[model samples]
Target: MIVMSVVGVTALAVGGGALLMTDNNASAAKETPAQQAAARAGMTVKCPDVATSLSNVPQQARPAVNNELAKMDSQVADAYQRLAEPGAKADQESVRTRVLDPLTSERRQTLDRIATEIEKVQPRPSGLDSLAACTVKQDQAAAADAQAAAPNTPAAGNTAPAAGAQGTGGQGTGAQGTGGQQQSGPQRADFVDIRKVKPNVKNPRVQGKGSKGTFSSRCGRNENKHFNSDNVIVAPGVSNGAHHMHDYVGNKKTDAFASNQVLESAGTTCTNGDRSTHYWPVLRLQDGTKEFDAGAPGGGTEGNVGRILRPTSVQLSFKGNPVSKVVEMPKFLRIITGDAKAFTNGTANANASWSCTGFENRQLKDKYPLCPKGSNVVRTFKFQSCWDGKNIDSANHRTHVAFARADGSCQQGFKAIPQLVQRITYKLAPGARNFAVDSFPEQLHKPVTDHGDFINVMSQKLMKQAVSCINSGRKCG
Candidate 1:
């Protein structure tokens, strides 16, 4: 009858999985009726005040902290959502293995990072105290989830478990009757939603290293003097003024108000003749010198303006809506990647898009970190490609395009298209070489504002070709 028991064998860890099912089941056999009742009815806890404590963090480190927090909250929230799945309640072990375990590890690292930054600036541990409390509450809930996932079994005695034991894999309790409810409403996300949350494990419908539809342009580059916002189109031809400055690549005639007609006719940066105008914020040196712009997108120049060049390759592929192929994307849709508003408006990083010497093995943070000598500094981008099947643009220019779930599936109601991930690299070997992306002066050369903007100007002919390549499962470059 005993359902829950306080693990007595190990030190209660915050994020790491606490105890094994063997330990719990071994003890559960002896639990009295009272213990079972308490176990069925999980403990009560209070929510942590994350914002008020974040105020104490250094202004410079706030974005990184905020970004990390969003990720953590998202981690837990995804688990809760899955907990509502059909089998989630029965197999707590499977749920813990796939979801909770990873969630705890990520939370641990995030808390440690927040703590480190807190110590760097302020003496009072306000942020740490609050975040720590939040983790503790989450940990308690996760433990209950694990316990609930464990099957009620008789004591197996004091027999020791083998090394690297993966646990009983039995049917136990889950987040259903244990983990507390978040909020009331159909729109409520079990976790925080600064942006949409992708699934934990993405099972690609079409999987491979080469299945892609690509368009290349050798058009020259253009580096504006400052961070330029192409908000003019969204703002109705405001002329050279938007959110921040941007460096346009591909199509020649690119301004906030430039239409598809203008873009199609403009000369392209692509030597191969693709006239697509691709652009992102410019990267400038911290010193604000002309030399740093050496490798930048040369507005009137061709081939590796200063330092920028047509990315070695521009890859496009379509991802199914978490399960099936995507339909055609409406023309003239405005898809914005990364956070431009964050750099200027003092809001949380929208995309928190980052870069590193090696995109696979990440190390940099909110800003672009200076890579060591003899390294290929890579600029990475993850665009919002999934469509809501309706609006081309939202009030924030983001809500319209849904993000892929943890498993790389488009959120419900969103049709998945090619989640275009443009990873560009620069050959800047170690030393005092000149290379940096233009960022807010306070941003300190970090790659936070490194967002991308693309207008779908593909004529019906070209669009049809792209659709064929994707739907037919061919790699067209």
Candidate 2:
């Protein structure tokens, strides 16, 4: 019996030891698979969700990194070329639109959201589980306790008293509640298309009268007075039919000295629709008038444009002031193309005619010598001294300009067109009025100014002159 008991006890003890060994092996088995995989695959045991935690980095720093990456791929050459171009305004707009503005707005919104999320983690002591989970029981109990409390009962440290509590107005729960009311929105703009306006068939009346023959007030005058031959009434400040007034009424003679002849023939009417009339301070408007006053008394026939007295009864008004006596004189003659070297020395044929717009000319006389002498038309005064901005001779500046003449020939030199007559002078005699004229100013239309090569030549000359003057201790100016 004793021998049997010892053997049984030894067997029980051996079985218990084996069970303890199995428990230790089971714990090792739990960690072995992960450790083996990490070692075999050369992988790490870091958190799989690491991106989510690191994404919590301040949003502001993210854009800076993105901008840096964009710059690495940017076209540096194209940017420099654009910057080097003339009138290259700084492009700060790109920085604001592409980077700063969007980054600032998004960062503000993200910061607000982060603050709200932080508030979600209950206001607990530091080191407490920031990610702690909460069940419904705690919330429910707190709600129930709050409801069961007396109505209007002031909570601790509250300014306003509770509705049914003992506290008066002094301690009442400060309920001047500015509740979560959204801010009032701004008023939106109303948009409409202005192109919907109907075209008015009847012309607008002239309301303003400017100077002599110039109707400054366009609001009240007749529509016919303002309308051109094409029935198009030009708006104020536009270069239209009225602007050609002087061109239309230029000197009535081709020969400057001939009383019967015009500075050039009134070849054609651009618009044959209607003949415009002007209110003059001279003799009556007659079919056949002769022997008119020359107006100029002395000064060597410089201003003596031939005139004819009218047989019909006449009235006169000068500069808008009514004059008692009337003497009809032919309009001022415009010298359209004459010599840049010599103006009056220009050749004349029976059909000779010239064309230049925005040119001015004064007849050569002993007092005001024709261009290049003491005349306003001359610019080459002291050869080198004519470079002064103050000494600009605007008349002769158009001298070298080339323009098509009424005879279809090219003419050179300075020429003037009577402002009223220019409208009709350039057209073929048979059809002046209907002709469509280019409205380009003389400067834009003619190649008068030597721009490219001339600039370099003049610059080099000036530089040499400047150095010479400096070395000689003399003033270049």
Candidate 3:
């Protein structure tokens, strides 16, 4: 199941055309423990992920199908917003009638259009309509249960030592916002103290034939503030396809409409002339200050309200496979690691790893870490290290690349390639818990929804240099 968002359409209405209003604060204050527990259990829209179901879509039909997919995302987002409205949950029957039913109809139509487009050039995908229906289900119980089941004992593994004494937390007034917290998320269960997590990271042993070198690109920490809600990799040409703001580095012109030519000609932040684009959802302090996009499509209006936190450090490094020599990635190769809609879509594709600078050995896939007084929050992404050897892109944007197995080996037909490891650190006040990553309105800003997007725009010569340095077992920049 997955969901998406946009502006304006109110999916739920009280009496004909009237908006339902309630004093949530007042009513919450009077609830008993049992009632409060029930209240914390929020609901979200869950629909089958249509994009992942298709493969081998004709290039001519891709634009239309992608547009339809974006529309489906918007439909989910709009429906989720309506579900989050005050008093909407109190009337489940009304919600099902007004919101879910209409959303299903809209999605069905969009799915049909997508199939029609694909049929124009290729055989129509079967059963797309079956993916249209969505359901509203409680969102918090599963996460809470998973948290409770997490191991408490330390596991045998190597851990990255804390970098150094923590720097001051991010620059902000640390003020609480008047806009209030996101209606559905970042529950107490969503955060865990780093001290409580066991060291669970275990690296595969490097074989004798391994390419043991590393190549790093010095891309600035997005100091110029390249931000947008468009995703050129998955939803090219669709504005606000992401439904959340992303912080970008490297490529200067990377909106949804930017073609490969535009990206190649664009100025870059990388010192090595690597025009590759690296981006991820911006983390925001839940302090109620209105950001520049507060009322815009992908910000406050879409249920993402907070002060954006700039990363204290962004490290982009390409490392070699531990089992075999690596191949140079094709120019314009795009890779998306982690699922942006993992909250409702499930963790099958969720690859987000959260940890504290000092406790990098203990990675968290679902919960955000509360670092010690001197430790900073860290988000690390170790992208796919194998490619299908032919396609630079895929119908689902993931099939072209894949992660290596536990022994650091690529699958039967896939070729091992340089693995991009992105590590971003953020300094936050000790014990701070009011922080979350930007996400689709319906995703409820869950930590599991954290994801990273990358496009390899390096020139052929530069890529050759990187591969040569890696295969020769030398670290280069």
Candidate 4:
């Protein structure tokens, strides 16, 4: 799959579908073996994303609302575990009775509480009750495999080429199947050779008033081993909110419970004295070696296993806007660039870009690139650059920031701010393809679910310096 920069315009590609079923005896006779296999694969829970509907949460109600939202995520995760258990898929009626029904009840109660909390401060939000129900769908990995096996058909996930296509630099098989680990995915269909992909990356057009400079932050490759499964920006005060381990860099004090005041007073890993927090899901090799979090809630217990692989290089750079001078990012401005639930939520918000060190021009959004010998796997995130001038965040954590248009201009009423580009590279063993990133169990370690998080805690002086450097067309660190 070719992934363009977040600021550039790309056509929306929808893949995957609900479970396929034949209605009559005539249709059943024509069903292929791949179709039968897909029909027998395990099911997953799909729920409406309540957070996305919240556009005007009052300030006093945010904490309560946020906690409720986090609770809904936990509810889904728990339901998924039940769905994956032995005998859980014995039959459709059994699954509905044992898992789906209970989950719907829990979600309904939680949604009610969230509505009550909001009503205490403002008018109650309508339609939340409608989001309470969840449904079972065919496992996406199985669906992709079935699609890949069909003649003249592309996989029903991301835009990677058909399976076993020639000229892909490395072995066509996936790396995650090693050590007999019971991972749900990183299936063979999820990888493609980097050499086969066309160069599809394009930058926004830089106009006459564009800020042409760049500012880089010298943060080490997580040498201190700051890893956790907490998300302070999205689920503050809630432990294990992320449900997958994260590799953190920049701010030394970051977790679900860290307040803005705590962050302001905390130390930093950035050599430039920037205290901003940056983090993303940790990548792991499926070599069967157990890490410290093994058996823990966010690690083995949550289906994220294997030895964590440290990145060889992590580059955090802030670049100028393409169409106008840049303004300083507000302190505590939080941005989440990619969708961590892309496997189930679809790819409308998925922004993960995977490539190889030498093949940087060819980016893959849905498939993990198979790098040839001597090449390292690379993950890059280009964050949104247009900020709503008044708020540091929004109810959904995304509305406060927007990506610039294809021409690199901010929408009316939005201001152009420095765009953050996070690039991390990992050196894997030659021909090794058994690596996967940590993710929610239902996400199945898919590359499309890879995401990054950022919170700007830069000092006022540093923020001003970055703005000045960008507007002046100078490269500064």
Ranking by TM-score: 4, 3, 1, 2
- Candidate 2 ranges with C-alpha deviation above 4 Å: 1-292, 298-344, 348-395, 404-477
> Which candidate has the top score in TM-score?
4
Question: What ranking emerges by lDDT with the best candidate at the front?
Answer: 4, 3, 1, 2
* 9-101: candidate 2 lDDT, tens digit per residue: 223222311111112323333433222111111000010111112222233333332232122112221222222222222122322243324
Q: Write the per-residue lDDT of candidate 1 for residues 1-477, one digit (tens) a residue.
A: 111122321122333222223334435445443233223221111123243234234555554555555454444444433333332221234435654566556666777776666556655343243233211112222233333333342221221111111111211112111122111000011112211222232244544422344432233434322233444334334432332246666666777567667777876655545565566755432222223323322211001112233233333333333344556767677777765423322334356443334333443324343455545555666677678898765533566786776555667788776555555555444432233443322121224445667666556676666666665555565
Clashing residue pairs in candidate 4 (N, C-alpha, C atoms within 3 angstroms):
175-433, 175-434, 176-434
What lDDT would each prediction earn against the true structure? 0.41, 0.18, 0.76, 0.76
| Residue 213 lDDT in candidate 3 | 92
Off by over 4 Å in 4: 1-42, 143-182
Predict model 3's lDDT versus the native.
Answer: 0.76
TM-score of 2: 0.13
Alpha-carbon runs more than 4 Å astray in model 3: 1-41, 141-183
Which of 2 and 4 is the better model by TM-score? Answer: 4
Candidate 1, residue 468: the lDDT equals 60
Q: Write the per-residue lDDT of candidate 3 for residues 1-477, one digit (tens) a residue.
A: 112221112221112212222333354345443332233234567777778767667878878888888998999998876665543332344556777789988988897888789888866766566666676655433223322222221111111000011111321111222344233456556789999999999999989999999999999999998999999988899999999999999999999999999999999999999999999999998766788888788887786777899999999999999999999899999999999988767788999899998899999999999999999999999999999999889888888899999999999999999999999999999988789898887777789999999999999999999999998899999
